[model samples]
Target: MGMLGNTFDIEQIEVHKGPQSSVFGSNAIAGLISLRSKPITDNFQSGFSISLGDDSHKAVKGFQNIKISNFLKVRYIIDYNYRDGFRNNILNGMIDSNRKKELFSRLKVEFHPIDQVRILGTYINANLDNRYDVWSPDNNEQFETYTDSLGEDSQKTQGFSLRSKMKINEDFNLLFISTRSNTQLVHAYDGDWANDSYWLDEHQFDPDSTGYNYSFYEKNKRSRHNDSQELRLSFKNLVTGFYFNNLSEKDDAIGYLFGGLGDQADGRYDFKAYAGYFQIHHNVAKKLKVMFNYRLEKNMYKYVGNTYDNYYGDDLPLVNYESENTMMGYKGSLLYALSDNSNSYFSYAKGFKAGGVNQEPNLNEFERIFDPEFLTNIEIGIKTIMNNFGYVINAFFGNRNNQQVTISKQRNVGDPNSFYFYTANSTSGYIRGLEMDLNYILGSNFTFQSTFGILDTYVENFEYELIENVKTRAGDRETAMAPKYTASFGLKFEKMDYYFLTSASYKSKYYYSDSHNKRSSAYTLTNITIGKKIKDFNLNFWVRNIFDVKYTIRGFYFGLIPEEDYPNQLFESYGNPRHFGITLDYGL
Candidate 1:
């Protein structure tokens, strides 16, 4: 969730969803995260590691590196981690434990000041603190299994970077990059049933005199600053080639807002953003490729305090808004090679997402304005590698426009004692997907890998008359953490010094509201690892989730009925249960 500085270190991570906004952008849509690290040869290395797990997890890591002769180099890394929370409240007996601490450090400097210059510098810092529990009630006896907690009340980040490369002969080349980043976050939560009715009728009384009281609060504070710059130019020979990429991004955000119910009363908001981009790529023969891109964005907003005319009886407390967005795109790809190993490709792309400012002070200022959401993607792919089997297949089609949903409505007008939710930019969608990956190398020891994915998402042309009597349909699916079959598999083994590993993951069945009504089921997880190497010291053992799957990953709902009268009461975000870990490594 945080990766700043070094603009792109992501080397290889293939998740599959297509068109990747011309080299990663548009939040990546939901896939594509490739990071690469570890370079600098002429070696002089160091390492240290320690880990212990199970409910009280702990970790420590270290690294120091050098390579100062061939070009220039330096590296340093330090890590520390701790974990405790596993949920347990039982009406304030505490122990929802939930604790997290993270500190990441990186310093890299490289210089090749002579033959065809090159330089790089990067620095990063990250901090995170978390607290848990947000829902519980699969029937904890009329709901009082204790609640109140939801994370990220604190988070911090800092980053800086510089990159340069140049080679002016032979074919020509130049590249430059600059970056700066800062971020802070506080997203609060506590929704103890907002307004309960003993979970509706879980046997009417006693044992605590029925349960469910009320409490829901919100406070979101965000401070972000970003500055980015990029430039690229390239030219090659042999037939022809050309490339140019330019990008500039600037963003500044400040926000503070609060929600009520209980202590009753607090509100404020602010937001801002600016963006820009440009791209070009060309190659007309050998497999062909062409690309073009454009982007411009702006947003500004401000709102202040109280407007409880009984939730909007007077409706006047939001009066500053501005938005501008422009996007243009073109893409082309064609790759063919049926002779050596195998290859095939096809693609199309277009994308945009911008439009904001809506904190719900009490609405009606046009629901605080919302628009801008567009997507167009088409893809086809095939790849094959012989000598030990390897495969990849992909398919995708998507179309979306003006869709920005998130409505939990139920204010009954500023404080029916309070329970509010708002978000708008309704309906226009279509999505289709399929992806597959497999690998096998059965001889050198044993190896196997697999991945599969499928998706069909919908909702189109919904005229939004406050949901148009609801049921804004078209195959309704795109929620429940957006799932429609996802899978992962892995196995590896090696002899000599001993090594073994296993992995599995899968997800299917979704619908967590958005009119599809609550539904979540389908889970599978497994992980195991074993390692041994006695010489320089290395030993490991691990087990994670291995069959203890309770499953829930995430869920939300505290008030506002609808979607089939709400109250399906299901809470069990348990996925990490059977965890046994041990690791040790030392080298110098």
Candidate 2:
């Protein structure tokens, strides 16, 4: 709720089922996030907003725009926000406050050099600064004493993109898109080791006493850069149809050392990928339509780095390695209209997520190479509209092969001073699911919508020697944070003067890690908003997480720690608690 920003509104969206990978990429494996933006026209527009909320969080945001003519336009947005965290540093006896600040801007221009040709260009930039702490400790226990030295971390990201389109003729067209992104993170932690106190006392702390000894202090910094480009050409008619698309991407990263009185450790990694595909759609009869698509992709990786002295000494030379992967797939779909407002369709598709280099080489000199995982999906669905009511139902079954899994192990090579991290693909798995949605309007002022999805995921095989014992017990349900069921509902009331909205989301229980031993409970969250418009001004109040549920969203595993010694450091990514805020906005 709250202001939700221009990209976070849920009520203004409608859910749809289709093979989204064709357009949005592989991350849409579960589903797609559809966002609606304000319409663009040759007009002047501007708006501003301010809010105050729980945890001492305050926010101010505003945007201004202009139409320099029929061919040029510009828009700018700025937001200043601050918040105090809910967790307390037990050691330091102070609130673990989290803070964020962001600024974003966009510019667009259109040019028509000829009667039949046009060119459009756009530019956007955004910067984000986030600071937070890792609340939970190595043992599944919470720290009552929080320390400023124990909880400090920050992350930053910036990105930009450009796209262009050309009309070759009435039946053919061409398009090109390019994008670049950069991200960086720095983190440090120091605290008392309740469980690892004995090991720290002898190795990390003074051997004299256990009372108030500085236990662990270390820092990690990482930087990533990504660049991508794509081009597409299409031609369609009653007969002889053609479509082709191609894409290429490059990514690189560097890791830096931060603390621990230890020598800095560093690593570099890079990957490149190329893919191309062609598809055709045709109507063979008045009642039937058929489509076919085929695609192929190749990926390569390079890595270099030295393990930390605590894990591996400087005597060991940094390793250099390379890997390559390739995949080919095809898909087909059929559609038939039963009536003017009703239609049914069935589709079959296959795809793969490319494998990459494992730069964290800790102990063993062996290189890790994970094979590409493949997915085959079969789905049938129907969509119908009757009067003011509409409904969509879909059922899908997917099978995945040779799934990649990461496992952590400890290794102390020649030097007694350092430690190294080595990775390998250790497991295989499969996933299948169903999804449905409905919408209805009860007269002119009220509307309702609902959506539901279910996934059944499981492990198929475990073949690694290091984790054989743990893998045997890992069942089909222990795979990652994927929930078995997810659902949401929304209600909206709108009129000439005022508007009201309410919605709720639910996710089924699932584990945070591959071990399948640590599980997170199921939870439901609700939100509400009310707003009024007067003249050219608008005001609204919103409440989120109405029930104040305490739940974890994610967890991190420290491979250095022995499993028999303690649980994987169960650092909980806590869900946001109950919060309320009000916003005032003016349009010009």
Top candidate when judged by TM-score against the true structure: 2
> Which residue pairs does candidate 1 place in steric collision?
9-36, 10-34, 10-35, 10-36, 11-35, 11-36, 85-98, 310-414, 311-414
RMSD of 2: 5.5
Q: 355-390, model 2: which lDDT tens digit per residue?
A: 766654432334356676666778899989988899
Q: Please give the clash total of every predicted structure, in order.
A: 9, 19
Question: lDDT tens string, model 1, 59-157?
Answer: 887777798777888877777666766555554555533556566677778889698988888777777676655455453322134444343445677
lDDT to native, each model: 0.60, 0.60
TM-score of each: 0.29, 0.81
Q: List candidate 1 segments past 4 Å from native.
A: 1-43, 53-55, 76-80, 85-88, 91-97, 101-107, 112-120, 125-129, 132-145, 154-158, 162-179, 182-186, 191-212, 219-223, 226-588
